[model samples]
Target: MAVKLATAMALFAVGITTGCQGMSEQATNADSKLDLAVSQALAEKDFRLYYTTGRRPVVPGFEQLAFKELEAQCGVKAMPGTGDTLRSEADKKARSEAYQYAREFNIKMYEACLNRR
Candidate 1:
């Protein structure tokens, strides 16, 4: 009975490790897809269209999944902030800072995903 229990525990550990490896592979693929999307957008000058239409860049589903996985792994907490009603220079500066922070956050998420398992 003890030997059987030990074998079961070993199998469970192997299963978990295999599952993590699969997830890591998927995350790597997701990361590649994100890079491709960014390259395509840059090549197409999508930023200009976004600016004209006031539409933000779309995050692909795989990227979103990878980000979610990274967020879970990193235990990142989101901070909610209130936007200023007036568009003063200070407000604009704050908004710019917020965007920088957002980009940094996403980059971290991507790195985390790529580093998984």
Candidate 2:
């Protein structure tokens, strides 16, 4: 009876440890997802601003300053090629549509980020 009780207690402790590890992993994943959403939103906002105004959202030398700030805050790397393709597109309507899409998408991402928080 003593041996059985000790074995049960040992198993319970192991289960608790495993459960805690799983919870930690889940929280890490949630944080990563939130960071990605925020990064994407920031990039989209910059892209929209550039498309509509024909200028970078930030100062010329520091085009990616917002991205760097995001990395400093959340440890998420900025996505590459954001707004690069939109620059050379010749059609004005296409550019306008892209800008609108970015605006709407940024709104959704912002909402998602808020919900996650």
Candidate 3:
């Protein structure tokens, strides 16, 4: 009986540890996806701006000008980073939603800018 109880407990602990590791991997993947999405959106925006205006997008002052234009014309605000601390599931969800919003907003602004040019 004692051996059986100990074996069962050991298996249970291993299962819990495996489950926790899977959850951590999932969270890391989620964060990576968010970062990739944001990066792609910014790249698209920069490309469109350069194509329309015939100006390089990487100049620091010009980038700030584009951001300010986005703010004024699209009423978009900068999205804040999650910083160094671990985020809860709810926080991750909210950040994902915010990123989606910003991405969509920037795309719309790009369209409007292209149309005006």
Candidate 4:
């Protein structure tokens, strides 16, 4: 059973290492997406008109109001628009703007939890 135990431990180690590498890569991608998103959001005001709407005016989303206030406090603004889905906006160049806006949803939902300080 010693041989089996050693093999299992080795497999476990390999799995952990592989999982960590994947996590690291995902983190890198997430950071780049997030940075681009924040910069874009800061530059634009009425996000409801950008990308998806392409400067067409429409009502903002429910959460957007909170973010709008946050942007005002930080003196930032989001391009007014949204993509078909929140998670996958950057797939197309035209949709990239939407993807960046989607990140605001991520920031408000996920990143806020990390800023407990």
Best by lDDT: 3
Cα RMSD of all models vs. native, in order, equals: 16.3, 16.3, 11.4, 8.7
Question: How do the predictions measure up, each by TM-score?
Answer: 0.41, 0.38, 0.38, 0.43
lDDT of 2 by residue, 10-82 (tens): 9999999999999999767756764675577566643222212333432222344584453343333222234
lDDT of each: 0.48, 0.49, 0.52, 0.49
Best by TM-score: 4
Sum up the clashes in candidate 4: 8
Per-residue alpha-carbon lDDT of candidate 1 for residues 1-99, written as tens digits (9 for 90 to 100)? 999999999999999999999999976776676567545644553321110002323222223444445444543333233233436878667655544
Model 2: which residue pairs collide?
none
Error of 2 at 93 (Å): 42
- Better by TM-score, candidate 2 or 1: 1
Off by over 4 Å in 4: 45-117
lDDT of 3 by residue, 4-47 (tens): 99999999999999999999997687667755765675566543
What's model 2's overall lDDT? 0.49
C-alpha RMSD of candidate 1:
16.3
lDDT of 2 at 32: 76
Error of 2 at 115 (Å): 19
Which sections of candidate 2 miss by over 4 Å? 46-117
